[model samples]
Target: MACSVATHNTKSNPPVTTTGSDSDSGINGNTNNTNRLNELKFDVFESITNFAGNFDLDPDQNFYKNCTNLSNYFLCDQFACKFKTVDTQKSFSSIHFNARSLVKNLDAIMEFIETLHFQFDIIGISETWCNENSPPLNIPNYTLLSKNRNGRVGGGVALYVSNLRSYTQRNDISLTNISCDSIFIEINQNHGKNIIVGVAYKPPDVNSNHFVDDFDKILTTIDKENKLNYIMGDFNLDLLRYTSINSTQDFLNILYSNFYLPLINRPTRITSNTATLIDNIITNSHDLPVTSGILYCDISDHLPIFQITSFINDSFQNDVPIQSYRLINPLNIENFKQDLATNGWDDAQMS
Candidate 1:
């Protein structure tokens, strides 16, 4: 409830004002800002994000010219949609972040979805209250990976991938296991590539990092036997602005010690700061040189950061994958659903 926000002390930036225009926009004041806006807008808004991400190995020389850069963020009126009205939209891909509510309007949701269909390679969703038993959704090139907390709402995350069968990893756990756990997964690159793509949401709590530590443990388990990793999610803690309780900087110390590096560079832009950065992309410190870093975005309610990490593959690491259950029979599914219908879940309850 009461959180201290952080501030941006960066001075290199020029003043920016989003010009109100009908079919087009004009910013005759600062061409430099316009160039930066143009550069950031194209790749950042193109829904089908396809950045190579951070691979610790020095890319095959001349990679800079070929390396992909994808940074897109969304805030749908309700659930997001792909739009067709914008005659000139990127075709590479599209991604939509929807916050559908029980009390929200329906048309606005459709419009947003129309806008979203414009482009997207992968899509991450939150606040979707649907469970495993619900009828399948009819979305093209889109396969859903959801963890529904309950039928009412709260604490859920999912990924919609195209050609999902080619990418492997399909989770068919029931509503009970899904509700009881947070949704976090590593979507590695094609052909056993080592990049681990992830998404997460933090509940409103001060002891959030401890929960993050649990998430980290899961990462540890996954990467325990496999190396090379990259993760992005709503971390909910801005180390620059937040400090934990119980006698000292245990959380920050642990986070940094684990080689966690937020996607932001030094003197990041202010996006409603409250002590620490609540939304972040974390990777090993080696991914960045501290001097050169990723671009920080302020388009959504949360600031999103994108890193152009150096190339260098990590040493092979082994991690024992966490024991995850698979749906066996009709009885197991019904029995698990019954258990969830009663106890449900609490945000405070972390594994």
Candidate 2:
């Protein structure tokens, strides 16, 4: 199955090189003075280059004192003083991994998270293998929302959202309702529309047609919400064989018809014998700038996939007061009258 790909164009500019020459006849007449001037120019250039390379320079150094004079030079542009402005855009990052059994690899997973350069807004885990008897698991500064399979041992899905973000779980379309291991949450934005994020896990043993039908229903429910949607998981259906497998083709058709594009094209799970593209992150937010890829890690058989979406901040005036009023209905009016009549007005008047 052919899919549309987005391309980006980057413009590159050549670096500027500077050279010093003694053009004055007076200076040229004196070779020693000309050589001295050339040496000085070389020293200055080297000093600037060294300063740019080293960030641990002393605050009281002569280089710091001369920064103002050097600001006129192109090489010193980075040292110029400027006011820092808050960015008007924010990014939402998410990562999904099939841990196989989260209980066994919790320590390794935490260590892996600590190694990340940036914090992820959402952490999705499939095949958690959690049951009612499973121990409570926690990650610092994150709220856990999980749906564990009851009366079973293997299938479960979990979502961990940063405490800083405001969100609400969507129980209406819970994965349990569709007989799948998944969880859905709506991320609340201060000004713009909210974003819906879901993580699902489809067992390989299940009937593909039933899975497709159930997944289609979930997509339909999400489409009706009309919000930016990101659905990720290990569906266990190799997308590389979309053309050959009817179920895989049907799955892609459902996603494409709903405007959700799968971002991961390369194989996510690889072994000595075979490689398959079963893990994926699909989203309907085509307009938003997104970067996605798989992270090479040894935590599990399947690699981790991540997506970073940049959303333009929609600023709103906080000073504007929201209008509010109380409703005056017959029931409220009667309740008010009954309360008034029930009060000891005669006793108060006599007092």
| Highest lDDT model number | 2
The global C-alpha lDDT for each of the candidates, from Candidate 1 onward, is 0.38, 0.65
Point to the candidate with the largest TM-score.
Answer: 2
Whole-model alpha-carbon lDDT for candidate 1: 0.38
- How well does each candidate superpose onto the true structure, as a TM-score? 0.46, 0.64
lDDT of 2 by residue, 162-256 (tens): 99889999988755333468889999987566889989999877788888888888899989977778888999887666657899878877875
Candidate 2 local accuracy as lDDT? 0.65
State in Å the error of residue 56, model 1.
Answer: 22
**Candidate 1 regions off by >4 Å?**
1-121, 129-139, 170-181, 186-192, 243-251, 265-276, 285-300, 303-351
Tens digits of lDDT, candidate 1, 1-351: 232112222335334322211222222213343233333222211111112122222131122222233323222311123223322211112232333321132234334445434334345544444556546543565676666665535556666665543344423211223322345444444332344445555554435545655655655554454444445445444433332242113444444445343443222223221112344555543322221122222232332233333332232122322222343568756766766777747754763
lDDT of 2 at 314: 31
| Model 1 vs truth, CA RMSD | 18.5
Task: Give the TM-score (vs. native) of candidate 1.
Answer: 0.46
